[model samples]
Target: MTIPPCTESGSSVLDELKAALGSRVSTDGELLQNRAHDRSHHDWAPPLAVVEAASTADVSAALRICHEHHTPVVPRGSGTGLEGGANTTADSICLDVSAMNRVLTVAADDLYATVEAGVMKSALNAALPEHHLQFAAGPGVDATVGGMAATSASGTTAVHYGTMKENVLALTVVLADGSVITTGSTTKKTSAGYDLTHLFVGSEGTLGVITEATLTLHPIPASTKMGVWSCPSLQHAVELVVKALRSSLRLTRVELLDRVTVDALARYTGYTAPVTETLMVEFVGDRTEVESQYARFAGLAAQFEAAEHASTSDPAESSRLWQARHDALPAALALVPGSAPLPTDVCVPISRLPACILATQKDIAASGLVAPIVGHVGDGNFHVAILLPPGDERAREQAEELNARLVERALAAGGTCTGEHGVGLGKVSAMAMEHATALQTMRTIKASLDPRGILNPGKVLAAS
Candidate 1:
């Protein structure tokens, strides 16, 4: 689907967009170039213009106009996505919802909050602290609520709280043709029509644009504990985590950082993390519950030959440790100067995580690539940061081939190609292989919702 090049007559569409949206519609060269690509390694492709949508009406109107003119529209929020979901195409209009950053309502009693699509998860959490509530499904980065819902993201906390798909109770979505629909409801359950809210949650903007979301919130845990345990090997670390995951303990966060990642984080952050395969686990609950769970976790690790198990209740210390985990990607990148990082995520069954990760580590060593592994081992999801030179085609190809083989191995082990990172431009080929005939069903849905393929062209589904 090609958007016609701008002619004297084609300029009318731009005029209408500007006239309808005032200064919100911008064709500024610098802004266009800046918003071209996301954190993904997808090559830049600037949009014809960007519309800073401030309201659901603005989103509807913009989409209505774009729909009428057959202009591709790429919905963007915060631009923190590691995938190329928000990256614009050559003839597209970037619909940025960052200006719609408002928390519409917070029903503390109902344990839900309604927020505009552009509300960042960190901002919402800050606001909810007073109420002892938190929106827990965050994707590490300060991503927008709408974007999180779009990509179905989950992070360290997801093992306990759940993913965006589970946390999001409802959504205010603008369809491709500018029709507004409220999916789900303030009530917990509904025996209504299809689960449209979920359909759009992980659709990656190919179906519609989410303008607002009503999300389920959790009460801030009464007591929380953080601990790091060093294991003899990656397999030992993963096996210990799998035991905890299967237990009745309510673990809030369980992460694994390989020896390379641990070394990198220690060097970059000046924090003295154990220089070995490590498992970082956090438990949240009542005082007694947290203490008991932490004890059980330690006991389980002891069976697997745990080297060290140190637990802490200090919030400040816990934050410092988790911050190191968050900084792993950047720290690893710093390890290989002047190299572009290609981050890939895969999830396998808990029982296969050890084999999958071990095989990947060996594969990386044989390929001679400087890649470090980090993971939320509680959920069997892990990420590899492969460093490739900026313009080194051979290095990029090697990284790509490694990524493919890793995904294949994970798939054979009954896992997914991508765990949280949505299938943007980077994982299209993997999606084809992973989904097989089911990929056609996705294409059909994409066509049904966006017949012209004007919504996020060249995303999720491969170009047919």
Candidate 2:
């Protein structure tokens, strides 16, 4: 659908929106330019205006105005998405909810918390420490709650605590028509009419704008231990991790970093470790149980000829190690200064992970791209940050082609095109191949809920 260029009628609609929203509406050129793109490699024309919604009522009003004016609306949070999910078009209104950052209620007794859409994951975790609880599922970065919910995000802790789809109990959403509705309840289990809460969890704001969320929290683990193992090769590292998963030991976090990624982390974060294929493992539980699990894992690693590179029980040291792992992308970018990162992720069955990653490594080597591999291999997911020179269209095409091949390999291996990152604008093409006939059902649902296609146009589904 071609979004019409803003005309005099659009100006009048903007004036009406300003009248209704007052100082909340902004036409600042600098801000508009900054909001035109996200952390992704994709860039678009600047949005016509930005509406910073501070409350559910503000979201309702903004959506109501945009719906009536036939204007496109792109819902956004912290703009930390790596898939261009929050990027806006030239004729659209960017509905930013970052200012709606507030924790409304914390039910420590019930192990749940109700927070506004814009609450940052780090901030929420910080607030939960006093209650001996935490919001377990996070996407590594300090992403907004609403954004995480919108993308069904999961990170290091997902292996144990589950993803957003499992943790979110309810959502307060504003529909495209400006109607407000609450889905699900705080109850643990309910034979409700429909699971609308999950339907919108990974909808990418194509159906409605998430305003608030009721999330389940977990008690902070009493004992946490982090360790890194260095393997002779990537194959050995992946094989050992798979073996550990099948064993009796329970691990909270299992991350794999290729040699290139390890080198990047060493230079960028000043972390000292053996420069080889590495597996970062963590165990959390009762002190005795944690230590038992660690010892069992050590034995398993030894069988694969892996050496213990580092181990720490101190909270500060463990945090530093994990932070370096999370900084893999930036570290990769630092390796090749003045280059853009085209990061992509894919997931396969645990048994096929070694083969998939090994083949991908070969492809990367042949393509001569500075793409480093890092992943939450415990769940069969990994990411490749393909770095390219700025404005190098030829190199970008080569990288995209390589990405397509990678997705094809995963799909053939009974895996998904994306593991954590939602299909914003980057992975839309893979939807049909990944979902097959189910793509039509998705389109039907999108049409039913957002008939006008005003919410986050050109995202997730094509021709939305």
Candidate 3:
């Protein structure tokens, strides 16, 4: 929805925001245009202004200014989201919180850390090495902690450590009317009242603007082991993942890459593995325990006809292997020059993973679309990145159709349309289709929290 420019009112609102924030406010055309969109393929609609919030107070003051003018405010982090969660329309205030990046407190003794909203995940982990503590939830992108919490992000390590929803203990949020409130507590367990912390965790900025977060941290692994196994087929690789997941191996991550993806990785990066279905597995614990886990994993792989077990315990070697997984998307994109990647993910029961992936592969082949498959198969989550050639509307249409069918297959298997990526503009229809009557309840919650709907309008719920 393109909101017409409120030239008169927008000028007043910008003036007011500048008055409140001085040099922090910006009405620069290029800056507003750039802040209006994220990594998604969504069309950009530039906001009226951009506010670089340096503190929680700045966020509150900015929100208050927009609230008084009945203007919409779209909160943004690093703009790394693949979905259109951070995209904005005209006449809206683009609140960039990246300036607020700061680690507030690190309670190593208590296994938690509090940070201002804009702290990047990699920076937090880097800061924790001296304390022998690390934030376990790892997304592929170096996203802001606030954005990770807002999207409830999970990645490779989530198969062991869990998602942002589990790691986050509390949050400092600035409500629509500039009211500040803290949700959750420092304690690990809390049943004191409504789980407001969770309500905003995946709210995608519809409920409030997250300013700070208290997150759970875990001790650095004493011993780390990683390996890559070659499988004859996708079915065998998935079977091996299920077998490993069912076992007591203390698995840290189990990722899968199809033959095409492997080829792409080999082409983009010098890291070459067997150009077949492969599983990258990791285990962390005491040296003896990690070795035992790898031995057991090797035995299971052998049963599934998986060969070429390349194992590593050295930190440098382990990092090199994992970097391949993190660089999967870019490598796949490199395979098809001048193509826009449409990445979508879904999660299903472990038992349904094989069938879901196989069927999706068949659908991709039938549509003749270029998509490479990769997944965190340990937890029944995977992504099908569709590479649509430039100016090929028909190919884009086919990819869209394939995506819908994949979602349907996942839904039929009792899974979500998205596992880690929240219901941004891309999945709003899927959310409604998946939730049915329950969606009304979510709308009620959104309405209650943001009455005027000035907070990130047209996202999560819809344009209505």
**Per-residue lDDT of candidate 3, residues 1-464 (tens digit):** 44456599999999999999998998777787779998988666888889999999999999988888889999999999888999988878999999888999999999999999999998898999999999989587899999999999999989899999889999999999999999999998977999999999999999999999999999998999999989999889988888787786678998999998999988999767889999999999999999999999899989999996477899999888888888888899998899999889999998999999999999999998889999989889999999989999999889889999999999999999999877788888898889887888998888887888899988888654
For lDDT, the strongest prediction is 2
| Candidate 2 residue spans exceeding 4 A from truth | 1-6
> What's the best-to-worst order under TM-score?
3, 2, 1
**Taking the tens digit of each residue's C-alpha lDDT, what string does model 1 give over 159-190?**
88889999999999999999999999988899
Clashing pairs for model 3 are none
What lDDT score belongs to each candidate, Candidate 1 first? 0.88, 0.91, 0.90
Best to worst by lDDT, what's the order? 2, 3, 1
Candidate 1, 302: how far from true, in Å? 0.9
Better of 1 and 3 by lDDT: 3
Which is superior by lDDT, 1 or 2? 2
Clashes of each: 0, 0, 0
